[model samples]
Target: MPDFADLRERMIRRQIELRGIADPRILEAFRAVPREAFVSASYAEAAYEDRPLPIEAGQTISQPYIVALMIEAAEIGRGDRVLEVGAGSGYAAAVMSRMADTVIGIERQHNLVQVARERLDRLDFSNVIIIEGDGTRGCPEEAPFDAILAAASGSHVPKPLVDQLAPGGRLVMPIGNPNWVQHLVKVTKAEDGRLQQSDLGEVRFVPLIGEEGWRDG
Candidate 1:
């Protein structure tokens, strides 16, 4: 078996510390989560390598730095309800569950949803809810989330996600043209429903697929 604890320390140093991610809450979540369990058995050894690795459903898990960055950008707090799009492998959602009171994750692939559900269940993370649907639309039934994170990249921010953001809520995602580079964006919605956008940095993510997003061909 691989030394997961040792790998976790290395990941914190190389991916979280060296990358300028200064949020202590985000760091703690990264440290608490076992990333190896979220990846495939074949790639378990490389789970902490600061690189994106293939997961089930033809999707790749985001790099640890990117995950931490996005979570930090969201500025999650204890007792906050969060919505996560593209719940690949359920790893990111699991991390968020630790920081937030509740987490709802949506994935377009049914198989990925199943895998994510099983993974979270096995880990005894009861605070996460995984659904199979078009994440671009967001989860209206559970609207007014305290924070929202999108794991995939889209040409623009989805309107539904913005609508679901609670007052003083934050939404973080990669936005840009698909098949090209994207910018990691952080959006904050005020009580009046106006959104303020900030650019975090450049990032690459799988294209988001949905009616308002890139259509998968």
Candidate 2:
């Protein structure tokens, strides 16, 4: 059997921590969740690598560094409710579940939804829920979320997501052409209702598909 624990430690030290992801909570969450369980059996041996790995529904789980970066950027707290767009394999949601009070994952693919739900359930992450729907629409019924993270790249930040953010909430997502490099942007809703935006860094992700995102080709 592969020494997944050792690989995970090395990944955290080289890929995440050295890259400046210093949040103790985020680091601990990564350590708690087994990335190997999130990927397919075929890819289990490579789970702790720095690169993103393929999952069902043609989706790719975000790299560990990227996931940690987004979570740290959002500044999720124990009392906050987090909504994850493009839940993918539910790995990111599981990580956030450790830090946030509740995590609602919106995934567009039906197969992925089932897989994510099963994984979360089996792992006993009772605070996480995976639902199937158009992620771009945001989870209106569950809003307003304290922190929102979108794993896919959209042309712009969906207005609905911004509207669903609670006062003082933060949203982290990638914005730009999907085929090209995208800017990881963070939007914060100020107490007075104004939106403040900042760029985290460059990243590449699949196109976010839905009414408010890129249209299906």
Candidate 3:
């Protein structure tokens, strides 16, 4: 059996911490969730690697470093409600649940939704709920999220997501073509409803598909 705990520790130290992800809460969250459980048994050995792995529904889990980067960028705090778009394997949501009061993960694929829900439940991550729906349309019923993280890349920041963010909320997502390199962006909604956006860096992600996003290919 692989020493998953040791592998996880090495992944954190080299892939995440060495890259400057210093939030204690974020670090602890990574430690709390078992990444191996999120992927299939065939890919379990690669779970702790610093790369994305294929999950069900033709989707990919975000790399651990990228996940941590987005979570850190959102600045999730205790008692905050977080929304995660493209919750592929529920891994990121599980990690965020450790820090946030509640987390809603939106996955468009039915199988992925089932997989995520099952994994989260089995692991006792009760604070996270995976819903099957279009990720471009943020969950308005549970709007005013303190932090929002979109794992997929879109041509633009969907307006519904911005509209759903609570004043003083932060959103981190990638913007650009899905087939090409994309820019990771952070959008902050000020208390007075003003929005400020800053570029995080370049990244590649699956297309954010839905009504407000790219049409199915």
TM-score of candidate 3 to 2 decimals: 0.99
Worst 10 residues of 1 by lDDT: 22-31
**Model 2, range 25-129, lDDT digits (tens) per residue?**
989999989999999989999999889999998889889999999999999999999999999999999999999999999999999999999999999999998
Better of 1 and 2 by TM-score: 2
* Candidate 3 colliding pairs: none
Q: Per-residue lDDT for 1-217 in model 1, tens only?
A: 8899998988898879888987788878888789999999999999999799999988899999889988888989999999999998999999998899999999999888999899899989999999999999999998889999999999899999998999999999999887788999999999888889999988999999998799888
Write down the lDDT of every candidate, Cα atoms only: 0.92, 0.95, 0.95
Q: What does the lDDT come to for candidate 1?
A: 0.92
Order by TM-score, highest first: 3, 2, 1
TM-score of each: 0.97, 0.99, 0.99
How many Å off is the CA of 63 in candidate 1? 0.4
Model 3: runs farther than 4 Å from truth? none
Superpose all Cα atoms of candidate 3 onto the true structure and report the RMSD in Å to 1 decimal: 0.6
Off by over 4 Å in 1: none
